[model samples]
Target: MTSSDTYQGLAVTTPVSLMFGRFSDAATPLLYARTLKELLAQSGLQKDDVDGLAVSSFSLDPDPAIALSRSLGLSLRWFQDVNLGGASGGIALNRAARAVAAGDADIVACIAADNNLETGFQDLVRDFSVASRDGVYPYGAGGPTSVFALLTKQYMQETGATREDFAALCAGQRENAKTVPHAVFNEPLSPEEYLASRMIAEPLCLYDCVMPVSGAEAFLVMSEERAQALGLSYARVLSSIEAHNTHGDEASPLSGGWATGRDRLFANAGLGPDDIDIIQTYDDYPAVSILQLEELGFLPSGKGASQLATSTHWQQKHNTSGGQLSCGQAGAAGGYLGLVEAIRQLTGQAGAWQRANVRHALVSGYGMVVYDRCLATCATILAAQESL
Candidate 1:
């Protein structure tokens, strides 16, 4: 692979989140429309002002980006349909930044929304990809829980991580969720309670899985000068990187593409892990979070559990928004959750759980598990405008 590239004079602002409970009768288009409306209102822009759009969803079947644009009555100069699952947020932000930098569009909205119908999730996973439809689902390995179960098990065995390590991660996020009004599982989760939660798959318990809900998360991308003219709080994109299927032939993979791109990710940003004040990792599962931390150079590979257990580094610096574990994963919106929260914290919009003097934040995304391993991995670092 090549070295990473940096984003210049691009500002990410106007974060919006509309997360319904475990289920929402609202259609995917309606969710997107609502999110866009909020985004426009927050940015003080008209529908005509947004000249670009980027969207990600799993249930927008028979409806591509063009269809959504038509439905939303948007006349866009540019558009992107992102399908990177949990990695969509960073990818969308990266692509939208490039679009604005290249003068393709003046203002871009990056949004991800989805609905949780009774059977929608099942249908999504069963036919997610050729690997799942033809190879994995026919035998009864229907969803990601089982696949991640095996991954978590192998990670535990290899890294000497225990259920307690995962429990700490979940419980801490739950505590953080308490201050987040939109979090679905805000009740304080103790380690004892996490351990006692029923088992969904061997080594994967109930609390370890993300609750699928229907909702949308969105943010606006524009030039730094435009943001200043609008008098808006914003975060500057330092550097972003993405890699897919980096493991190649490793079927039961225990790692992700972050390892392949992390050095350049930090190097291009001119900041090391210690410089980051907060980190928002895609927490589809605790073990996956651990892997991301290790791969991102937060901790040594095999020492994840020990370092996490013994130190407050992760406890203080990680997932200040409670993550998908507590907030409920709204399909592709799970990808945008961390990004939105990072923008919030950086922009001084994060209410109670906001950290003081958060100069920089790191957000990572992992998603699209076809069968054994997640295929998409992406990360972006953002700095508060004042810090720049």
Candidate 2:
């Protein structure tokens, strides 16, 4: 019930200024699409090669299809605007796969963009408070950090976890980020250093949080039949699920909604956790992501923190790309940054951070309900080839 038709080839493209970390004195800024046409034109596809446009993002002022339409001078047969929080990106990829199979459109594009952190640091932190739902905003400021703080506190109380234990997660993920070229935070971390880091919330330190970064990534999606015709090497979209925990007060009881979402999606795909080689977890904070993994069945519900700090998990390639904490966050597009990394790992192109012989990738998008702290979540498993 959760699986769908597969896609042929998937390719990633980004705007020029966003590609290199050398311009602006190697500074990264929010990507502007003025140069996207050139990069896209160089994609080797004919001008009319694309017929479908699917964009999942939070920060692109003008949606991508409309922008790409004027820039590339093409009309589209299908257009999708996915506004879900974290899970929005992967959900779009799943929809594109189904559309390709249904003959809705070929050469569909799944796009997620990131922007520079320098220009918007203050704006972002302040806006975090405004992100609360109307109902919860009155009682207390229910932003990402506050809600996760409450959740992290509960996880700690239940699991006998300590801030030092959580620090293990910060230290480990930072090490993972150091191996990733595009990672903004390439610095190595230590548990002691993690303990010393300034606390933004009660338990989460500065390094425990995901930074705001400017950039964008894209995937060219098509049917397997179309892929054979084009001769491209890419992955297929296997399964996807999106569930809204619109009521976070209720989410407190489950406390494992994200993992439940992943289980549901993979069940639909007819596979279990063992089939996945890598995963990109939605992480605004390191602990939330770590907890999400356990809920995802990689570890027991309350065992996320323990596994997060283990050297074996890294060697096993579970959360390989350092997660959003080390990379950078761009609202909804943050998940795609993780997806792009997963795609790279699967395609043997992850460069320095490539996991050894990766194949299946399960990506989880955990989003703030826009109503409460992580009110909804979505997960998708992508494969290099047909598995069944």
Candidate 3:
């Protein structure tokens, strides 16, 4: 077996920032610039040090990653435009790690940002998928809420999950949001409130869906030695996996591609589900979060809703940053939320809501819900440098 140590040598270190909530003046490029500026400032690195870049954005149309490099005055040796929606962050991390390990770049900045102006979200939803525009939207299917509501209903029927189960998860995340400085929804949420909230789609109350806002998230990937030399604390990527168009035959997806490579992911990390100390899932919807937990082995298949309702484990440290549901999904930046939050928790930088003695974090992403199911899925296992 190839030694996991070789892969673990690559690390994601300091200079992580998440800007949440609405930004009317800012466009996508401005949001990207803001995150890049903070990343450079925090890492104490000059723009010249960023030899590689990876960008993810929904509204950065007519401009690709290469275009942003020039706009930002960055002459890069490597660049990538990740458009995988929520999975983009994981893929970016995986790519950046490989780039640094292969000597393609010494330092890489992975960023996802976007501005959600008036009508911006409606436009995105209208053109999100061919199936949506051609088939679903015409019938007023109500975009992702409708799509996910169908999935949630199926999941509940199969697993005997009640609306309260979903409400509990949303309420718990809202409680966690209370400590995050940038979270958009800081109000205490009770299960009663969640249950009483207006229903956007059947079985999916207003609180069950994520609020779209404008923001950005960013992080740096480089050699562990480079991070240490910079006096930065870092998180090591124990293992990562990505898959596309998984389980395509299913009418609606109850599981994601994370399960396809989950065994390999754990094997490469030399760890298992029980070893994880924290979890961050791409929570565009509460039901999606539950599905990711099941696919990633944190909860048993078909048991996520029941476990979430009954278990105290999820209430404590999962989605410690309140997730996008509370922080507001900032277009493509939603993909990086969990990854950035996991890095924070693992590096002991998650102030206020930081869990004690966090050594391992499991982060997962699911995106590109075009037709009947999400086409992209990815997961990562991050460990504290000391644990490595």
Each model's backbone clash number: 0, 10, 0
Worst 10 residues of 1 by lDDT: 1-10
Look at candidate 3 and give me any clashing residue pairs: none
Expressed as tens digits, the lDDT of each residue in 47-158 for candidate 3 is 9999999998888876765788978889899998888899999989998988888899999999988888788888888998788789777767588888888898999899
* Rank by TM-score (best first): 3, 1, 2
Error of 1 at 330 (Å): 1.3
Runs of candidate 1 exceeding 4 Å displacement: 1-6, 331-333
Score each candidate by Cα lDDT: 0.88, 0.62, 0.85
RMSD of each: 1.7, 4.1, 1.4
Estimate candidate 2's alpha-carbon lDDT, on a 0 to 1 scale.
0.62
What's each prediction's TM-score? 0.97, 0.83, 0.97
**Tens digits of per-residue lDDT for model 1 on 326-349?**
899875849999999999999999
**Candidate 2 lDDT trough over 10 residues, lowest sum:** 21-30
Candidate closer to the true structure by TM-score (higher is better), 1 or 2: 1
Error of 1 at 300 (Å): 1.1
* Model 2 lDDT per residue over 299-367, tens place: 776766776666566434655767767766653537566666676676666677778766688887776
* Candidate 1 structure, TM-score to reference: 0.97
